[model samples]
Target: MEGDGWRDIKVVRNPYFSLRIVPTVVPMRYLELAQLYQRLEKTTLKTLKTRLVADFLKKVPNDLLEIIPYLILGDVFPEWDERELGVGEKLLIRAVSMATGVDAKEIENSVKETGDLGESVALAIKKRKQRSFFSQPLTIKRVYDTLVKVAEISGEGSQDKKLKYLANLFMDAEPIEAKYLARTILGIMRTGVAEGILRDAIAEAFHVKVELVERAYMLTSDFGFVTKVAKLEGNEGLAKVTIQVGKPIKPMLAQQAASIKDALLEMGGEAEFEIKYDGARVQVHKDGDRIIVYSRRLENVTRSIPEVVERLKRAIKAEKAIVEGELVAVGEDGRPLPFQYVLRRFRRKYNIEEMIEKIPLELNLFDVLYVGGKALIDEPFIERRKTLEGIIEADGWIKVAENLITKSVEEAESFYRKALGMGHEGLMAKRLDSVYEPGNRGKKWLKIKPTMENLDLVIIGAEWGEGRRAHVFGSFILGAYDPHTGEFVEVGKVGSGFTDEDLIEFTKMLKRLITKEEGKRVWFEPKVVIEVTYQEIQKSPKYRSGFALRFPRYVALRDDKGPEDADTIERIAQLYELQERMKGKKIA
Candidate 1:
């Protein structure tokens, strides 16, 4: 396509809100683009001139002028794909190359001349050509598949390979196609749309309900599956795929209960209460001698916790089994240590043996997922718990979690208080008849934290920060639930808990959605939901809603939750009541 033709399509694909203008499509050709540019008005021509220059400037090595466009656009980096590339390395290489255009051999001499690749790309593009190569059609499925393939092929030490692959993919793509390709590859869509937006788009494209799409995604974690099914059997094909046994399902979460009484009430008098441990959630899969340890997200973490793998291989009686449990670090006294201590062991690289010696872990078994090559997810919790208890032998390295079956909510509440007194989080309330359902968050499993405070907040806006927060979004402004109007009311802001690196990364992220400016802040469409943590809940007149959180911090961004699922003002009031009651209490 002509450069102008590509630019026209770009304009059409990315139109400003309230603008209904459309561009004419023309045959792809450089000469045609040149002609179109010549016919354009001075103002239009001036706007097109910069991009044309930028395209030319990007030929330099280590120039961000070349890298920024690619990052913003999302294109394949054939140059870096020889291996999987870390976020830092990829950005550095792109920046360096765009800045100096010098070969590696000449970088030492040119480094002083061009400080960074981004600067170079910006400078170069300002004076570079308007057109060169065109890109392939971009889609979310393609981007996700490419990442998976990269992860599969690169294994562990393939950073160069990954970047090279990305370069090759984007080398010939048109600038606009390149943009989406780059964004998709990074697993981010900064165009004022949250991750859920893609799910919504997929549902609309497939003509199916959001729930159907969600169920399919939960089962496969593969966006391509949805697209494939839509292409084959239409949206109905999504429903055709049902939850199957023998396949691991997402475990249910629990709410924190303040005391034994509280636990019993939530569980409706009778309940199966398990000691909520301060540890990591692990799913052990065993097939014959082969063993794998997966995290709650189904990520393969076998290598990180080899000791756990070895223990599973030795302790489990079944030849083939999959079990869910908590892996906690234990002190010499045999008591479980804090979760942070356990997490340090996960991040260890050098001196792993020494770290392992210092931080021994104990696996607290809960549910058995599979046994004898048959899936146990369809089985009731009581049956699965029995099977789990029967198969795993308690050793110094592994033991079954402390569990009890009680008919009174009072007993459950007592256990909750004991768990807290032991420096644990809270208790897990599970339905005895329930089966494991992977990736689905529902009331079947409720996590009862000690605090009554919970807020249902909507993401109203986000800001880009400096240093490490330069690229991704840094902090967000969360709004409260307005019961009367059923709308989100701006309440508080959360800017802490983010690392310097996160600030830089997220800043670049939020920049893409920079819409209209409001004083020092930029507003975004309310879409994302996040569950935040706080020391206490207090009434405040500063916000539109009379509430505020003390020491509020980002807990987890809730992609599964829609805006409507957020906590209400009434719920916040309940939490405040609990907080007040606990303030004056002195444990005997």
Candidate 2:
């Protein structure tokens, strides 16, 4: 794992086109790896990492540092510096050379000419190999860590150095290892395996209940922690772990209540209903002097909303606290702006000052999970509400979410209409006595959109799309989960609502996970879940699942969800039933 091992791997993997250079004095394993590449016609990052690790552990007597670079950066030479190359650029060159048997120099020249490394790689690979060798397995945690490290690095470095590192890592990987590495780099894995697959794997591996894994994931958003514990303690340690606050619990989804009154009815006739705002979900943590803001995906977004961070520091009256709220952007007139407008502000890297001035945001506070060094997840909703209200002083920029204690469905309905009139989404009903459940979406809370219904679809198959989508499989065929067999049955295909930028980004991402081809189509491992919005749901014999969504559009990718948590067929049936109920009630 030393630096030199990485350098050596980078050299071998960095060839422009196919080269028949024999190693002067390399280990047998290294030679074996190269021969395997020659036989397989291609190698991936995941496979390389696994082989390198296994080889290292097996005392294979190879230069692991040289191998680490090959596995991590795709560089196999001793002279390359990873600091000089961009991860994407390195991957592009390596992919091209591997697929085409073309000289790495030719690919690099093409990349330099077009300044489109991704495109060059794609073309090279396409011309070199008609079919992919294997699919890589990628997890979100690994990618997140890698990106964080990438972001941490500083200074000007040549793209070639970076490529060398990435190329070397991938060239030395094994199939399964490559699968994980590729998935991580691409940022999505559609293995058709539910989150339950990993959960079950972890549970069995550690000997802990599935519930504990769920709880831990909810609390920390760290799957690696569970895996590590399972590796070390052997299940008993995992079972003994308790869920605590300040550890970051998952945000609960607001339950849909057609009217404020209906929400109260769901809460047993008298309940607390909060006005669901049209804004971004934000989780704020204050560790004494340090304040951090995270999105629902647990991404560190403190830099994106420095204003909110400043506001929280002033308004939150606690020594140490972790709270959740909705971040709403407002116009100069002081009214809340559209959610899309708020999102645009976050997406921008340039002219941030101008954007912030043009689209100021306010934080509408909701749940409080920690205060004064104590966790509040175990507290009842009512108690937590009181604690939150007591700790935060509402200001022009930060305010408590509007709520009402109601007894009848009619009253709840009235509030719902008022919120809609204010251009809000809808209402969120919570069980007054419920505890904060991390990583679980249940009846304790539900989300009711203002207009069209939302479907929590499980992604089944994705095709490598055209134009900008040539790299990642852009259009996804989604399905409803079958509870009995624990499978995803296709319901519809969504190809709209994605920005061109997103299309390009996703294409590069999806390409790495492709496992097989069917005629002109490529298949992937389905593990990602996305929330889709549609104009209507229709019964269909054409789709594999016997259903379809009209005007289906991308809403957001769900990182917090597990495949088991995807919308089930029974839930689809419930939506249909609810539609019918609404029809009958309306006619009456």
Displacement of residue 27 (Cα, Å) in model 1 is 17
Query: Residues 36-99, candidate 2, lDDT per residue (tens digit)?
Result: 3233224333334334433332332223322322332222211111122235545555654654
Worst lDDT run of 10 residues, candidate 1, spans: 60-69
> lDDT of all the models against the reference?
0.57, 0.61
Residue 23 displacement in candidate 2 (angstroms): 32
Model 1 agreement with the true structure over 298-321: per-residue lDDT tens digits: 445566677777878889988888
Tell me the lDDT of candidate 2. 0.61
- Which candidate comes out best when scored by TM-score? 2
TM-score of each: 0.63, 0.70
